[model samples]
Target: MLRRFGSKFLQNSLLLTLSGLYSTAALHAQQPAVNPAPIPLNPSQKAAAIAGNVQGKALIQQATALLKSGQLDSAIPILQRASVLRYVDPTSHFYLGLVYDQKGMSQMALENYTLAIKRANALGMDSAQLRINLGNTLCKLNFLKEAEFDYKRAIEIDDKNDVAHLNLGRVLLFKGDNQGAFRELSRASALMATDPNLPLYQALALKGMGNNEECKNQLQIFLDRAAGTHSDPRVISMAQNLLAELK
Candidate 1:
């Protein structure tokens, strides 16, 4: 537990020093979320496009199976071939990017996501989400300013994007602007009445603001939830320990 805490602490520090170019969230910036939404093609039209174009659908299915089975390297070629053949559906690109991102191939993930977004950027396009994703990737690469650009644009497009707000809060926290972090995170928590994983952060923010009673209350709630669901052990632990500290 101590080691996990230390590791998390180091990760936060590194996120600040290494990825702190701008105050933007990096949730999916490099590829998936940062990339544009997939344009929906009619299923019949898509099937017709590849009617004689080789077994694109089959290959994509194979790639999916491979991914689910944990054969990442094997899935890559199959997915890429499908992508190159116009057999690549938006779902294919999205999942392909998912695999690439999981493997730390940020550039590859970004490329596929971009392709998916461009192909699917019409009606169903969640442009703001794409910007946030790309912003996240940008932050990881130390392009803080660019990341900031993406986040700000995302806010402009949709101020109510909860993930965007939460991500921005994390970015602020890493930047050591505790007040900024508190404000953003507090808003996020208020919006998170439906999400049970955030009380720990809410507690942290309250504690930072010297609201020990509020912090303790949030911590108790966090512990109660954690015991039932195991959804946030680290947060529960931290909240508990912090509550003890404040006492």
Candidate 2:
């Protein structure tokens, strides 16, 4: 169920730091709980399915298949085609951005996200998600100041966006501002326990403040809880290595 709910930003900085988190795959897994009964699609809409586009119901499902199968290389061409179609929706471009990000094609990803952003703004669409994605990408690219501005803009648009807070906190932590990072991470943790990054980041923030014992305990708790969560190998490995060295 990789929906790419808000990963337009990761595409831009995927080469620098490939972290997508629950914003796409993990966030989509939560959808069933939110919408227990999906409305049936109309037959006329079924006829609108791309006829010559490889026989798929729509470009989106085809792209999803490519992504799920890890055939990212094969997906890009199809995604590009979809984006150029007259009837193509913003979601098409959004997922294209996600694919490029996952494939480590930052420039292409950024371009797609920018396109999506423009279209969303034009239609007064769900622009907040695009802002979050762009902010996350900028943060990874080491453009922390600009990324922070995007996150603040997102907050202004949607005060309850927990992912934006988490991302902003991560940037603050990387900037060596432990106190500010802690506040944002704490708020994100309060909003979603599924976010392993919160506790793991909290430990790092504590470590930065020279609270060695507290950091160790928090890291141990995070490691234990994160074991079955499919946490990224890189993130888990880095955190574990850091904790061991700290002790």
Candidate 3:
């Protein structure tokens, strides 16, 4: 049964929540709530806002297409123009952060992600995915505490966010909070039962808590599930080494 489940998981692994990138559905999920008492705008002001919004949408669409085609450099200017628009969508800054992150520019990614959050707030929008992306950049910059905070906030926004829970588990592990890491990992595992990586993380947390037997069991489960899949070779190697050490 486990093998069958593992094979099914491997086949659908592309849909895993680990990646911090937002899909079109996720973008829509982050849409701002309707304001019951929106501030009235004058006719000219509303007309100008509509024009800016239309232009910004076009730029964002163009940038998204470039990003999809792996033309990260070309996407940058278009997204930058969108970011400066009068009614800019926060998604522009979010995409800019993703491009910078993919380019290995952690500081630039962090800056854009910060701007994204600020813009999102201004637009009366809150997004778990945005927080997750920002947390990922923070992790890359070695800002573990900041990343933890972001992950926690993401969870608060959407408690069912398995990515946030998984990331929070990782951060807790790094901070040597073994029990806390285990608790978060358990929650993530419950939320995403098919994720093979969860067992590895759970094993690490168990090992940290000196539960050698349980850790070994989790390592074996990880190895079994990861076999014949596209799991990271480095991670598999580490799991093998850890399992051997436990033995």
Looking at candidate 1, the ten consecutive residues that score lowest on lDDT are: 23-32
Candidate 3 structure quality by residue, lDDT tens digits, 60-175:
88988787788989999998988877344577888888888788788998998898788778767778888988888887766889999999999999999888898888778767
Error of 3 at 157 (Å): 0.7
TM-score: model 2 vs. ground truth: 0.65
lDDT of 2: 0.63
Against the true structure, candidate 3 reaches a TM-score of: 0.81
Error of 1 at 220 (Å): 3.0
TM-score of each: 0.58, 0.65, 0.81
lDDT of 2 by residue, 1-247 (tens): 1323222222123212323442432112211111112225577754554353334226656776777777877877777776665233465567667776666566666677677766665555545566677666565455778878777777777777788778778777767788888888888787773576677778767866767788778878888988888777776766666566655
Instruction: Show pairs that collide, candidate 3.
Output: none
Candidate 1 residue spans exceeding 4 A from truth: 1-71, 87-93, 104-111, 114-129, 132-160, 190-196, 231-235
The best candidate by lDDT is: 3
Q: How many pairs of residues collide in each model?
A: 13, 1, 0
Candidate models: Cα lDDT each: 0.61, 0.63, 0.75
By TM-score: ranked, best first: 3, 2, 1
